[model samples]
Target: MADDIHTTREPDGTTHTTTVVDRDPKRGGGAGITLLVVAALAIAAFLGFQFLGNEKAETGAVTEAAQKVGDAAQDVGDAAQEAVK
Candidate 1:
């Protein structure tokens, strides 16, 4: 904080004084911003990991469906060969 005083003399030989008060500038604001950024990155990483896990589960399901279809196809081919015989 800062204070300033001004004194002035008028034409009527009267003196007037005034005081001004100023606020101090803030310091070390960067630490709060850094903390916010770190928090945001942490949340993003957590969400990304969760999404990756879900993707792996979906991929496994798709692979299992494909395998079942392939097995069915093989069984149909074996039945056709038996019929021809």
Candidate 2:
């Protein structure tokens, strides 16, 4: 069953057949390779999500920081004007 069986017919009423058989099935390598590929893809997906989530959080923090900076600048300008009076 492990070996491939093939049969062919020739033009002049001739037949050809080929069969190869293995006493034992070759094992191992295939399943390991498949598992490694699946693991690699899973890790890639997880890291991609983590990076995107962190990027979104960092952008929000930057926006908040910018608003705080604007408020502080306004307070400084108000103090300087009061000193001139």
Candidate 3:
């Protein structure tokens, strides 16, 4: 918010003047940026804890799923062999 002025005198003795003004407002983004960063960090921390907390349970569940799949495959193979006989 500043004003710049210019003045000139013509050969006819009449004075001409011009004023240029800047009216843009200036503000700080630190508060918004700080809030965003804090929110992101909080989300990351929450997800990290959830992942770590369920790690062992997830591994055991995966192992059980694999074994069940293996058993199902073996049963299908046996049925196919019997049909081929």
Candidate 4:
């Protein structure tokens, strides 16, 4: 048995019909493109974050090494002054 079908009339006095099988193909394509763009942006953001994190780590290591070198030089200078006394 067929289900009850509904009908509607347009404002211009024309009969317009709609069915479940009638869908807009462009909508499907648009959704696919939107998903693809979002995925691409996500990947790009991840890579950018990784690059920035690595750069910060490298900078921190360099700064720590420089500070240690400066401390050693000060110690050596103190030792030299004590020897001359």
Candidate 5:
């Protein structure tokens, strides 16, 4: 009489008696795509805050701000011309 058993040899010169299981390839790719989309949305929100926050400085304040900017530029130009002399 013989015993009821089975065995198998793998490709790497190894013997085993087990079953192999396979997994889907899309699971990992889906996770990577989800992370990328979340990161993009976060960056867009940060930039939107920076740009929109400046628009609410004050009502009817554009002329005063522009004049101040022009005066500062003129001062800088005078200093540069003096340094060159």
Candidate 6:
């Protein structure tokens, strides 16, 4: 920068100098924060997809249907035994 500077004292008692530096600490903060937020959102989305994405509902429905069929069969068998008695 034009204002940024470097200086040295010479053996002849002369001083050599350069411009002063201009610094802004907040310059990259916004971009860093944005990146952090994006990363967090990506992680959350991945976790959500991992946990919520599956065929469990279909499997559960099939299992429940099978259980109902088994119960119906047991009821029919019991009725037949009673008739025999």
Considering every candidate listed, which one attains the maximal TM-score?
4
User: How accurate locally, in lDDT, is each candidate?
Assistant: 0.97, 0.94, 0.95, 0.87, 0.80, 0.86
Q: Give the better candidate number (2 or 5) by TM-score.
A: 2
Which residues of candidate 6, in runs, are more than 4 Å off? Answer: 1-17, 54-85
- TM-score for each model: 0.65, 0.56, 0.42, 0.66, 0.40, 0.45
Q: Which residue ranges in model 3 land beyond 4 Å of their true spot? A: 4-24, 59-85
Candidate 6 whole-model C-alpha lDDT, 0 to 1: 0.86
Can you give the lDDT of residue 76 in candidate 3? 100
How many steric clashes does model 4 contain?
Answer: 0
Each candidate: RMSD: 4.2, 8.0, 9.7, 8.0, 13.8, 4.8
Give the worst 10-residue stretch by lDDT in candidate 2.
Answer: 19-28
- Over the stretch 1-85, how does candidate 4's per-residue lDDT look in tens digits? 2344457898999886655454445655888899999999999999999999999999999999999999999999999999999
lDDT for each residue of candidate 1 in 1-85, tens digit (9 for 90 to 100): 7899999999999999999989877798899999999999999999999999999999999999999999999999999999999
The sequence of per-residue lDDT tens digits that candidate 6 reaches over residues 13-55 is 9999977767555576888899999999999999888766656
Model 1 ranges with Cα > 4 A deviation = 4-23
Query: What's the lDDT for candidate 4?
Result: 0.87
Tens-digit lDDT track for model 2 on 1-85? Answer: 4887788999998999999785775787999999999999999999999999999999999999999999999999999999999
Instruction: List ranges where model 2 is wrong by over 4 Å.
Output: 1-24, 27-31
Clashing pairs in 3: none
TM for candidate 4 is: 0.66
How do the residues 1-85 of candidate 3 rate in per-residue lDDT, one tens digit apiece? 7999999999999998999998887677889999999999999999999998799789999999999999999999999999999
Worst 10 residues of 3 by lDDT: 22-31
Local error of candidate 4 at residue 22 (angstroms): 12
- Best-to-worst ranking by TM-score: 4, 1, 2, 6, 3, 5
